[model samples]
Structures are given as C-alpha cells and as structure tokens.
Target: MTAATVLVVALGEVRSPVLESVTLARTLGTPVLLSLQPLSEADTDALGRAGVARALVADLGEARHAPAVAGRAVATAAEATGATVVLLPTSFVAKEAAAHAAFLLDAGLLVDVATLRLESGELVGGKRVFAGTWETECAVTSPVAVATVRANAIVAADAPEAVTTAVEPLSVDATLPRGLVLDEHEEHPRAEGRPALAEAAVVVAGGRGTEGDFAAVEELADALGAAIGTTRDCVDEGWQPHDAQIGQTGVTIAPRLYIGAGISGAPHHHGGMQASGTIVAVNVDPDAPLVQIADLAVIGDLQEILPAAAQAIREHRES
Candidate 1:
C-alpha cells in the first residue's frame, strides 16, 4: 500500500531541519502529523507556518532526556495516527530514538538519508556509504519505515496558505529503562550570534595549522554568517570545543558551503563533510589532502588568507 500518513518527530525547541522534514512530508501526498514533546505556543505558530494540520504533543516530564522514552512516545503517535512513515532530523538523540522506534514497530530504519522518495508503494532512501566514497539506495521492506534525515537534504519552504494545526495530547506509558536513572542534568549556555554548526548552511572550519589561534577563522565565519567547526586535532589541542569538532567521532554535517583551513583531510574528517554541496580548502601545503579533494584550493597561510577574505566580504556587503 502507498504511504497513507507521515509522522515528523521533533524536540520541543523546533529546529530548522525539523521544518525541512515537514516540507518533505508534504510532498509525499500523505497526511502529516507532527510529534513534539512539551509543545509550546511558538511551536504551534511554527507548525502553522509549515502547514502542519495536526500535532501529537507529549509531556515526558523528567524522562524527556531518555531516548527510549522519546522513541516509545513516537511509536505511540505513529500508531495512533496510522503513520506508515516516520521522519526525524539526524542527531545523536534522534538516531537512538529512531532505532528504538523502529525496533518497537518492527519497521525498517534508515539513518542519515540524503534523499527520500516513494517508489512502487515503498519508501526508498539514498545515502552515501563507505566514508562517502559510494552512493547507494535502500528500500524499506517492512510495513512501516523510520528514517533519520541529514541536514541540507532538502530546503525548507513555507506553505502557500496558513493552517491552524489541531493539537492532541499523547500519553506514553514508557519510562526510563530499568537501572537507568537521571540524577541530575545541566544545560549549557549556547554561543550567541552564530547558527548551530550541524544546521548551518555555510561552515568555516580550522585545523592544526591554526596553531591554537582561531581568531581569523572566527572572523571569517562571522563575516559570512557561517558556523565555526574544527578538526579533531584542534579540539584535542584545546583550540576549540568538542562540539565544534566535525569527523567520524564527532558530528557529521552537509552544509551548502564548507571552507576548510589548515586541514589535512584525514579520512575520518572527510567522512563527516564529504557530502557538502561545495568544499573550499585553504592551506599552506600545496599537496594537502583537503586541497586535493576541494572544489577550490587556495595555497596560502590561512591567517593571511582568512583575514583578507573576511575583509573583502565585509567590503562587498557594505558597498
């Protein structure tokens, strides 16, 4: 049978990729239901803007941080709405939740899918594999499909007309698994005036060549309104935070534009960013691996090149 209904699961704090998933769901020609934990008025407004007609709001209380709990809630919503496909944004928590939801529903799971389509009444997904060296398509054979979609997979669009979403409260019986307890939790303050690294359209990253100095990289990132990322070496050297590190061991990004400075493009690092729409490499070494694979290679000291590029961008914007 064709996909009759689609479910898009997101956190209480709406993310851009969640909206993009909603936009993608609309194209499936199915009834789309949003599942949010601790829904808020802002979320409802955003849903209306995204053209969502219904939402399943769950109040997970203290168990909100538990992926299993979230996953159970998602499964319940999918069952209640008769959703054949469940879509979520790719994140650490979302990945775990998707896996758990798929297990509960006995559905096929796809992670970090770059594109999705309906073919012959089946959900098909395209993804890169083997460290982004090869592309492959996967079709879900189960009755239900759960997929965690990557960022920049689809551009978010606003609806042609406004919609008032009908909100429904979902009750989840699932709780924290046995022997697992959340004693305390701490929320970190987010960096201001910059977009989230995982969701940024443009990313400016530095590496060992920065010499523990990220001033130039920061300036260039700010000039282009881009997020700042760093290689594992930079994070290990304390030049950047662990959250800023992009690699197999850290976060994977698929920004529209990625600029690498002083990076050697190790396989681990390449796996994280190889899906970027365009890559530009700036390094002093003419034969750096990043330069070799970059769409544009600039041979120069990043300290000099970055500042000059930032200056040019600022000047052009003012002119």
Candidate 2:
C-alpha cells in the first residue's frame, strides 16, 4: 500500500530528524509521533510547537534493552494507527529499534538517510555512501517502509497550529533473545546541561593540539551554545570520553557550523563532518590540512584565539 500515514518513533526528546520527518509527512499525508517513554511536559510543549498531529507513549516495562522492547511497541502502534511508513532518529538506540521493526514487519529498511520522499507511491531515500564520497538513491518496494534519518540534514519549519495529542499504551512481547540477563550496568558520565552533539546547530571540537586541556574548547562551546567534540587521540589519552570522539570510528555529525581547534583534519575525522554547512579551522600552523577544507581559517595560538572568540561572541550577544 502507498504510505498514507507516518509513524515517528522517538527515544527521548523529539530530535531534529523527527521534525524533518513530520515536515515530509505533511507533504505526503498525516504524521504521528510515538515515544518509548512518557513525554515530559517540556517535550510535549516542544512537539506542540512543532505541530505534530498525535502523540503516544509505550513503556518499555522492565526490559533488557530499549530497542528490543521499543521496536515491538512501535510495530503495535503502527498497526493500530495504520501507518505505512516509520521514521526513526539515527541514534544508536533508535537504529537498533528500527532494525528490529523492519524484521518484524518484513519491511525494507534504510539507515542514515539524508532525504526522503514518495515517488509513484513508493518511499525513496538518498544517503551518503563510500565514506561520504558518493550519494545513492534507493526506494522501498515493500508494503511498509522503515528508515532511520540523519539529524540536522533538513531545516525544521513551524506548523500552523498544534494538534490535540492522543495517548495510548501498546503491548509488546518482551522475551529476551538468547535469554540474556543484565549482570551489571553503569551509565557513563556524559556531559551535562549542554546541547546533544548530534542535534546541536553548532559544534566546537578539539584535537591533539588541546594537549589534554579542554577548558578553552568548553568555554567556546558554551559561548556559542554548541556541543563539544574531540578527536580519537584525545579519547585515547583519557582527556575525553569515547562518545565525544568525531571520526569514522565515532559519531557522524552535520551541523550548521563546525569549528575545529588544533585539529590536523585527518581523513577519518573530515569524512565524518565534511557535510557541515560551514567549517572554520583555527590552528597555529598555516599549513594544516584542516585549513584547506575550512571556509574560514585563523592562524594563531588556541590559548589566545579561543578566549578572544568567546569574548567577541559574548559582547555581540549582549549588544
């Protein structure tokens, strides 16, 4: 069947991809949002502001992992709503759930999709391949399509008005695979009170030149309301967590603005963020490879450069 309703599966807060997916759905049909957990008041308000048609939640209920439970919940919601297309944010958790949902529905699945649309009653997507060296278009021929969309690939637009949300509980079979049991689990100490790296409009990243200090980079990121990232070298040196690393081995990002400080722009690193709308490189070496790809380059010491930039932004915002 042609896609007539879109089911957006979200883990926590409504990500930029959800908004974009809704926007695309509006062009084709109706859009409804489904969450794994109950939406907070703030999250509900944000969704209303973004103008989603309906909102529903399904508790994971004592689960080994979020994806396994959440995926079945999504399938149940889709069946209840008659949604023919399911859109998930491309986070690790969401991707896992999307994969599970595809298997359950026997639907075609796509990941890291940069664009989506309906052509001749089929869902078509465009994605980056070959380490960002090529773009490929693919279409889903199955009755239902499930896809995980990249964050920040599309601009979000406000809707005319907020719709009254309808909430429902979904039933999911939670039999664990291989009877896996949690022996022990501890959450990592992630950065707090800051924008999430994947959804941030701006990002300030440090590299080996940081020399085990991130004070300057953090200050700059705070000034710009940006997220912080670091190179793999910094992660290996225990200066930053592995989650903060940006490269082929780490998370891929496509922000409106990306600023690199003391980075040499290795291929692995550049391949992850080369799709950024704007790139700025700051390094003492004018011959750095990062400078060649940057829209703007500042040759100077990071100690002097970062502080000055933060102060300038502060003064500009105040004025």
Candidate 3:
C-alpha cells in the first residue's frame, strides 16, 4: 500500500490517457515521467504541466525502438526511481513497449485496465472479460506492477497546487535486436484528419446505407471532434479502411458518445460499441436494430439529416 513512486509512460501529443494515468498515480503514489527514446520538448513540457514530480528522458541514440531497447529504457527509469508501479496508455506503441518492459523487469503486466485503486497498499484493477460483457478484478503481488489503462475511463481533476517538475536525462545503452532493422517507410494520405477511432471520446459510424459515400459521416465526425467508423459492409465495398470497421470481427470501442448513421445495428456491429455511454442512431428505417438501443433515434434520410446536424453543431460551436 506504500508505493514509493509510480512511473508513467508519456504518450506525448494527443495523449488521451495522460490525465487518467496521472490521477491513477496520484491515488497510489507520486508519478515519474518517461517518454519514448529521443523525447520531444513538447512532450516534456506536457508532462511537467501535468504535475509529474520528475522526468527521465531516455536517450537511446539511433536504436530507438529495437524491441528490447524500449524495455530497457523504461526498466532503467523504473529502477532508478525505485518505482513500484508503472502506468502506460493503452496505445499501440505503449502496449508493445509494455509487453517487453514486463519481461525485462519481471513485473506483473495488466492490459486494458479500465479501473484501478489502491486499498491497503494493494493495487486492484478491474478489466473487461469475455468480449466486454463481464468485469474481472485483478491484483498483482509482484514488487513492480505494470498497468495499461484505457482512454477516457478515469476522471482527472486539476491539482490544487502548482507543481514545479524537474527533468533528468538518463542515457540508456541497449543493443538492438539482431535482424530487426528498420525498413523503408511509405506514408499515404487519409480521408479525414480525426483522432484515432478507439481513443476518440465520440465516434460517428456509418454502414451499408452510406452508398459508398462518407461525406456526411466525416463531416459530422469532424464537427464533433470525433472519430469515424464503418460497418463490415462498408469496408468490404472499399469505402473505408479495415481499421475503421466495427463489428464482432473488427475493433471494439467504448466511447462516451456513439453516432450510428445509416446502420441497421446488426448484432455483430452492436457487439463492438455496446459499451458506449450514449448512442444516437440516424436511419431511414424506423425499426432498425440500432434505433432500439439508441438514446435518441432519428428516423429520416441520412443524406439530409446528417448534413443538417453537422451544420447545426458547427454553427452552435462557433456562436
């Protein structure tokens, strides 16, 4: 119950879980900062403003993310601070690094933790089990516990006092994993500039009824500062990327708000976003399955309703 320090892996810009992780650390102990190798000044400032007690900028030089190298960087920071707990955002990069860090430090790793608390000096975590239908509690007995927290799952309140954070540089000397050199990269343009689907607080999803056109969906999503999603049919028709598909066979998301447009609310698709806090369905069919579960159901032509809704929201926000 008496953790000396909690090391938090900073997600840098677009950090969805920073406040949540900071709050979690505050409940258990103090938070120390660590970023991916070759840390940026913006990320350092972000950590300092969030009231981190101290930061360890890992200088990995050229071998930035050579699997074990990332783990070694984090492990070194944890050891230096004598950290009892390590909290990281449930992001793709952080999750990958956490897996390796757990092995290197021999810590108990908990992934997708939605809730955690410190009771009698014991860290108890709650996570989803059996396809997000059931909740399971987990507790670690190891000296160092590593937990990856889901985004937007915790409430972050502002601290009462202004904290003066200190930054310390810790250079890590790690050998790259053999045969894991970086290959050439190819960057392609995306349809819209929106947040990652899983991490977004709001999501606007379309289905087969979109008719190969996602203008309305994208517009509404962008207006609400939300992410875009699609059904399996839309992806199959090449209207959206496979990463945007939300169904039983695709990615699962639990945002604060979910808007389903031109969707029938199939069982498979519902399984993906059933955990959403609020659902708003816009469909032509009055009896669409999505309408049954939605908090607000709009029965109309999506082509007309979507644009009008987006415009109204834009105007309201501007006003």
Candidate 4:
C-alpha cells in the first residue's frame, strides 16, 4: 500500500487558503489539519464545517517572538504526525520557518506555491519565479513536501463533513532558546487604520508623475476607502511615507483594484503590483508600459485627474 498523503496547515494572521488547498487535496485523499493553538469553539465549528480533523497545539509562537526555536518545535510536531505535505503562508518568517523545518525533517522545500496538484503520483505546484515574470511548475515526492502559499491567491474552506475525522491535539516538550530582546515598543492605538499596502484590498499609488504632490493621492485613497501607496521617487522626495511606497524595494501588493497616478508605468513598479485584479493608470505620457497592462488608461495630469476621480467615486458610492 502507498503512503497516505496529508497536508498540514499553519494558522497565521494571513487568511488561510484552505478552500483551494482542500479542493486540490481532494484530488489526492483525506486532508487532515494540524493546528498550532488550542482552537476555540468557534474555530472548532469552522473546522467542523470544513469536515476535517482538528489537531491543535501551541504553535511555535513566532508571531510574537522566537522564530528559529519555534521552527524546530513546529517541524518536529509536523514530522511526528507523518504529514506528507505542509502548507503555510508565504511570509519572510514563514519561509524561513518552513525552510528550517524541511531541513530538520530532511525534505524538499517548495516556497511560494501558487497552484498545487497531484501529477504522476507526485505533488506539482506552480511557483512565481524571477519577481513574477516567469511561472514554473515544480513537483516533489520526497516523502514530505513543504510549501508556503501566497495569500489572496486562493479561498480557504475548513468545512467539516465526515464524522470519522479523528480529532487529535498534539503535545510536545522542547527547550526554549534564549532570545535577546533589545527593546520593547508600545503598540499604536490607531494601527489598524494605518494604510498597509500589502494587506490593502485597494491601493492608489503615485510616482514621479506626482512630482512631489501626494495630497491628491491621500485624498483619492480616502474617498475610495482604500490605502495609499507611492513609488520610489515619491518616497525619496519625502512626498509620502516609506511604508506606503510600492516598488521593487517597497511593499508588494495584490489588491483587488490598483490605481496608478502619474506613474511612468515602469516595469520595476509593475513587478510589485502586477498581481492586482484590475489596474488603472493615469499618465500624460500615454505610452508607458503599464498603459498596455492597465484595464483603463487615462491620458491626463494626475493632479487634476486624481481629485476628479476621487469626487466621482465618492459621489457614486454616496448615490
């Protein structure tokens, strides 16, 4: 008999891609869950709705601190369950953690899997390579394959259906490594309201076309109830905060809607937001590379266009 396949999912602040993975997992066999924390009743209900077993334990606790140590413990727990495939969010920490775990378990690591499937009795996944320019399919059958999935790329469904799912909570004893805490800063109260380009559903970004005028960028974002972003030039000019910038060196966003104002539509910039569902660029040059990629291109100065567009959206939403 062949080894039964299992996909272990880690819970993080990022939305789970359970639906997509579960659909893909069905093409293989039973997909059981390996949770890190003791799930609450609500979490249990969610897992039950998805028709999967819940194996809860205190995860590595890397969200707050201790990533390296947590990696070993998490990897040990995963190996103990004999999970064939491990799915996790694709973050800097998650990637490092997954890499460390796979190293410990002596498995192959497939970072940032955009798609997954069973091919020729092996697991095949689509990965974004070379800053999203090249897409390649990778397959692994190294006893257990570790993968980190990108958020917003797939819908998650933890609906429990079959009652035969064996719910098992895990317990492991591991030594806590000494960590250096240089400083502890107080949490901001209005942090949730802060415009985060990575997590923003919609992002309105400006570039050199703004020429130091970011007032309209913020205005447009507020009108649309979206987050504001900027290009390298804009950030360099001190027109906007570095945190709101989106480019090769800045935050990457895959928002549902991306509005580019006065941006030259540089390829480097496009690399950051190419995953956006709908792209709209407003530029006077009219022949920028992004113009071809944009769903709608407006040939006009951004200063005037931004305000008018913001007003129009505000009116439309109010109506």
lDDT of 1 by residue, 1-319 (tens): 3677889998547768888888888877554655546667887888888888888878787676678888888889889889989999888888998998999999999999988889998899999987778999999988899999898888988788769988888888856889988788665555676778888889999999999999999999999989999999998888898999999998889999999999999988999999899999999998999999999999999999999999999999999
State each candidate's clash count: 0, 0, 1, 13
Worst 10 residues of 4 by lDDT: 182-191
TM-score of each: 0.95, 0.93, 0.88, 0.77
Question: Which residue runs of candidate 2 sit more than 4 Å off their true CA positions?
Answer: 15-17, 62-64, 183-186
Clashing pairs in 1: none
Minimal lDDT window, size 10, model 3: 182-191
**Candidate 2's residue-wise lDDT over 160-238, tens digit each?**
7876565666665666667666455465554665667776779999999989889999999989989999888899999
Choose the strongest candidate by TM-score: 1
lDDT score, candidate 1: 0.87
Query: Candidate 1, residue 43: CA error in Å?
Result: 2.4
lDDT of model 3, residue 205: 97
Model 1 ranges with Cα > 4 A deviation = 31-33, 184-187
Overall local distance difference test of candidate 4 = 0.68
RMSD of each: 1.6, 1.9, 2.6, 4.1
Model 2 has an lDDT value of 0.82
Q: Rate the local accuracy (lDDT) of all candidates.
A: 0.87, 0.82, 0.80, 0.68
lDDT of 4 by residue, 1-319 (tens): 1226565555442234444455455455665665555455655555556666645455544332344554675576667766677776665566786777788877778887778777676778886777677879888868777787765555565444543345566664444546744244343232344445665667888888888877898788888778788888778888877777787788777777899988887767878888777999999987888787899999998899999988998899889
lDDT of 3 by residue, 53-150 (tens): 57777766555545467777888888889998888878666787788888878988898898887766677899886656788999977778888988
* Whole-model lDDT, model 3: 0.80
Best by lDDT: 1
